[model samples]
Target chain A: MTEKAESPAARTSFFYLAIILVTLILSVIALSLGVTALQGGDASAGSYALVGFIGLALSAYMLLQTQRRPSRVTFEMPQVITTILCQKCGFKNIRDFQRGDYVFKEAEPCPKCNEKMMIASIYREVKEKEKERLS
Target chain B: MMLFVAFIFYGQRIQMYIMIREVESRLARLKFIRDEGRKMAISTIKEIGKPQEDPTERVDRFLEYIAIAPESMDPAGVVWKLEHVLDVRDIRFKDEVRLMAPEADEAQLNNLENTLEAALALNIIYKVIRHFYLLGKKTLSLYIIMQLQMVLPLIMREAEAFASALKAFATGQPIGDGAGALVAAKLMHGHEKRRIAQDIVVATVPLEGRTAHVLKSEGPGGNVGKPGDGIRRIIEETEGKIAAIVMVDAALKLEGEKPGDVAEGVGVAIGGPGIDQFKIEESVLKYKIPVNAVIVKEDIGDAVSPMRKEIFDAADTVIQRIKRLILERTKAGDSVIIAGIGNTIGIGQ
Candidate 1:
């Protein structure tokens, strides 16, 4: 089954948009109250205005920054099973499995020969080769 | 002040996260050990039991037998009889377990033949006397020879003891008094326990329409009816004294997990109705008997042939637990029930 991947930054941007929009409306309400209270005393009105400005600024910054960074980062062709063959003992190993599979994410030594293979590099080489052939 | 408070909360969150991570890792390791244990147990059971000989090798054995027995005689049949029947098979039987005495003169042999005839006439024939000619100062002593009279029963007794011990260890039950009657009582305790669970009566439902041949056909427990019914019968036969029946079956290990992993789960309803265990448990609850189950897990392939060491070791654990529980629950005359639930294939029920 295929799934459309959503980036973490995209997911965060939506979250911040909702927060900033609510914060902006709350600041407008605070400003209206401050103006109405200015008739009684200017000191309380000035403090309210300062607080509203800080709230709006913080919300805007949070919204923009969340959109800037990616929400999720995933490698290309994650579905492929990559195996690194060792020259010395002729060992073949599956380095990575599909999601919803076993959690063998740590570095593993070949049980038979105690030889280690860098699965990430093997995947990288395969990707490079595929790219070269495509070009 | 706000920053300090936030830092404190953050630290607390970090601690919680670390604790959860530790727990998850430990749970993973425990699961792995259980799975690996199951695999080893199965391999060991198969290894200890006699290995099946190849068919061609069996045929060669048959040929050897034919060479000794000739056309008319059956080796086991003839060899099981008088030691000196003057048949070609005696030469082959010599290599086997039954051996003729070197000292028997013609007169003693004649007397033995007469006695054998008399033993057969009185319906007091035994396999040992038929195979070997007994010769001694008195025929009475020879009749009670240890090999002929005691060894077979001893082997059977040992097998039963091993099975009983396995059950007791697996279930955490105490081995009862060493008295023969008590042993029999303990064995019956398991049967009686299964009887108390009311769901056992359901086993009789399927037998209402099925023929005897159909019921006796080769299948689970040599019964052709639905397995749920069989479980029900097991419960019924013991009378509503059993609380819950826990069938311990070996499940196969996943490729990732090491072999002999002990996987424990409420198995799906086998031989029909979704969870027959629930039915049995419900029946027990209806009768106010609290029901619970413990499955000594192994892989499916190795369930029948769990290794002797693993079985014995696990059985030890089972027996200890059972003994503690029974001692706690039982009084002087209280009937405690325990069952050695397994597919009694090679186990020699």
Candidate 2:
């Protein structure tokens, strides 16, 4: 089986994480700047503190959203559909095949013909084209 | 600084909202597909109950079934399996027809079988699609949803191809995939048609100084008859006289590869669960016969859905390649088996 490609969610999450980290780093820089300005008795120290606080809050919210988001999803092989056709009346019915159904095996009775519907054919649905288009 | 921070946060929130909306829309699409699948299934059951419906109605119902079917069922497998059941049914039907009208000829018997098989193949194709489509909906997992989204188009294409193939069979028209057989027919004059296996036919085409045993899954209808069995039988009957085996098939091209591109390789190029490929490999190895593969590249969409103009055009290229390989690889008077490997849905020899 082909490996599942990385999901868009995963790629976007990486970018989100990078933004969060950058914001956190900026907050740390602002915190030091505020501390130094306050020691120097600068009035802008309060503004620096406010900027740092807002940066912290923004990063925290981004982090929370990232944690709450769903990760990339994967899947196993698809299922097969089998059809049983009533030879007597030519009536046909289909369903997800069970473990026991085989080609030519006698299956449930035809609702119309009253004769047993033989497992006329079993086929796997082709889904490759849609996937190709998606990729 | 405060205003800048507020602006950035506002932008982030809007971006997040848009992303969520996209995901929600995707989920909604999945739900829609699932519902469609269920409706198709219901429709199929209804169609089956009415066996006296016209061919166009039957075809429409079958297409509906395929549109909603899940992606797991192999279309080729369904057609191949139906060929078996239809073979038995065809025999019985033929017997009945002959008994009723002793004037029924071989051509009439064949026509009857072809019609039945085509109808069955179309029906099976739709059911298979509905099965997968509904299954995907039921799962409701993002992974499965994405997978279904990808495969649904392919299933639709295959359905269309089968529909066309079925139409041709009903009307007695030649289909496009029979290119390999066409090549064989051109090369070999006075070739006799014989069923090597159920729905698989072979003819002896004499090449320039060599005999080419050409085989294809019987068609002008939907059928990918068991070529593995046919090849095996030819190998056994020839008693090791076969010098080389050439398998020609329509292979799925990777993204960026040109459709109808011709390529050569060694080993069995047959696709699927590898059952047939394994059988061919075993026979070739046991007989010590060299195996050569010639493939006409096509996208997954083109390979199964229908024979596109480009794919049909590739046939001439493939034929030239096969002839060249036969001349270069084997000597005159050496018996070679050339098998056209693919669903012979529409093409006929």
Candidate 3:
């Protein structure tokens, strides 16, 4: 079998970043050159100024395109929450889920009644993000 | 002029090449995810199971393990054949998990088995995608490549869901599929329990002046027990005298639908390779009993990943609906079977 590559997210290509960086650098150089040429009354000031504006526009477009695309699939772990219900007082306490937590497990004492609270439910909150178009 | 001529003559070829390139990139992503899933499984087995030596080889082998489906040429008794195949597969899987994680308890064994299963699922997806990707490249078939590319997004989503399930299973966290099992656990919490079927348990609970026999997959592990067989047993043991059967489970929701939305239908709401569903269907047919279904809606991703708050809260709504179904369909002192059909991971009975 052929060697599989690393996750693209982790290995964000320097190639694209390089292009953006070079464009911004060139834009700066062109703008400075245009300014120097105009201050010295150089004959090619208009062409220099035009080149600078085009480079700046190209860099801005690239930056926006990169930002607009959905971020790489990091696949971060979700935050699971545990809900503990006190049977006596009906007081509910919400907290971050611990490793050993399970549904219906008798857990910590309730602050309200000092009675042991039962872990009523343990689940993560999921945001249903729209999927990218595959059609 | 020569370049223009080439473009005109080979436009389709060029497009195919571009498409192949795109597929290659996604295939790489799939491979990475599959590898990560395997690594997580191995680490979890090591952490929880505490096996003696390095389990890298055994874990890799387990990931590649496959279940052969029984021959379907003879349609008669196919369900029983399939059930036998599944039973053997489950036994073999459990034995392998036990060997790998010798120190793990029964619940932990089930959870570890679930972790491996999730990893195996991811592995299969990666391999299948790669197979088609390579076949398309070799034959240079546009349709084959296009079909694979089209379904790749859904495939990726499912793969991601299974990947998340590894952690959920390893930690014994309840998943959305457990919504049904959670309901059963809630109903049978303080009631007397008895074994109804393989890895299934039942408790007799009195509800609204009716005798309700509520059952679910024996859990606090990740097993989805044979609820179908359990129902058949209930019917036989009770001599088909039950008034009605109410089945509760998590149903897959379409896009734009609310996750926790509850829907009512008529049937045994067990989702699997159809072994359980077939049994329930047969039992219902034989007894001529009306089977009602109450489902909690969730997306495919939500089904396997850790149970979401909405899906969790839907448990109560489902119970209430089940109560309503019982009250309206049957009278006081009547017997009813409430089957909570799902994986009972973190939800205990």
Candidate 4:
């Protein structure tokens, strides 16, 4: 929970390994096709070779990317907010949470009616992931 | 052909190696954050406690404090022993905090205790992961490594939850776990309270023309007082004349369930060492009293984090449910108990 600013995707290593394995499997399939085509004296040998080389090249690129330096993990602290409500005027306001703040504590007078407000609640807002809605 | 042969012969080994590397990286992060949590705790103690002697060594020892498991093979009356062990453990922890932070007030000491407890949880999490990682590596056991890796995400998540709780505890902020206590506080806001049990306070608030004995932990600091003992004592004192028991607490929401949703049901609504639950159940069964529950749903992570806005608003909903349950379950002028079972941090009654 420090204020560090850099973090890679949490599953980066496993993801890279999966990608490498998949690319390797694809390269082998492509190479096997090229080998079979050439041994059969087929006319499609050149095309198979081209596809095989492309697959091999892509695999190398992915492996090189994974071998590069990993990103540092970072922690982002959540911001807590305090909610105040005025009983007389029903005036409600929210502000950044401060030390010594607590629930049910008396706070500044309301601007609307000069009535005192109470710290009704103090909490951090949880940002819910947006859902895809059907029209 | 060579690639195929290699895959056929050593595919699982390669996968195991990759998995180990992944676990290793996460374990490193876990260690770093564990150490960071410790540093925060020590620095906070130093700033607030201002002890003449450095508390680092003492804090480390505190982290090592372990709860002894009571023998349960003889299941009869084991709950009593478990409760006693928990009581002793709780007292020792508080004593430790007091010794290290002699300058801190009661409130500060409670917060310090909470901070240290969270740090201790993080410490234990780190040690477990490290132990398993080293064992897996030393023995070259794929199954052990696989099991550890499988549970690593869950372990890391719990560790992060505890880590986040440190700030809330240190700052005396109400966390999501306090949703029930908030309801109790709101209900008993203008009433006077008397200590009914260890750190528990009960306020007699008139609800719908009946005296509602609303109870919760003494607050403005982090404490989930012994509500079970309070309820049991009240039941005994009233000679089983109580109408009903309406309890409120935060329950863990299932996946995809909205946080702050309120649910009403029957039975005791407390969670923890089961000491409180057992007492309440026994007292209720003996008295033949109907027990009802109103719970605010929250995820396990949210329960430890600072009170979420949704959960904060849900407190009002829980109160509403309690009021409705009382009116429907009890006749006019019949007294009842509304037990708010949860940590009463940053809330007062």
Which candidate gets the maximum lDDT versus the true structure? 3
Q: How good is the docking of model 3, by CAPRI class?
A: acceptable
Clash list (residue pairs), candidate 3? none
Give every prediction's interface RMSD.
21.6, 14.8, 5.5, 3.9
Residue B127, model 3: lDDT of 94
What are the runs in model 4 whose C-alpha is more than 4 Å off? A1-59, A108-116, A132-135
DockQ of each: 0.01, 0.02, 0.30, 0.37
Candidate topping TM-score: 4
RMSD of 4: 4.2
The sequence of per-residue lDDT tens digits that candidate 2 reaches over residues A57-111 is 9999888876764543322233445578998899989886553343445778899
Model 4: which docking level applies? acceptable
**Residue B17 in model 2: lDDT:** 47
TM-score of chain A of each: 0.39, 0.43, 0.44, 0.54
Ranking by TM-score: 4, 3, 2, 1
Error of 2 at B193 (Å): 0.9
Q: What local lDDT score does residue B101 receive in model 2, on the 0 to 100 scale?
A: 30
The whole-model lDDT of each prediction reads 0.33, 0.60, 0.87, 0.86
Off by over 4 Å in 2: A1-135, B1-50, B53-190
lDDT of 1 by residue, B247-281 (tens): 33233434344222333333321222233444545
lDDT of 3 at A92: 98
| TM-scores, one per candidate | 0.24, 0.49, 0.84, 0.89
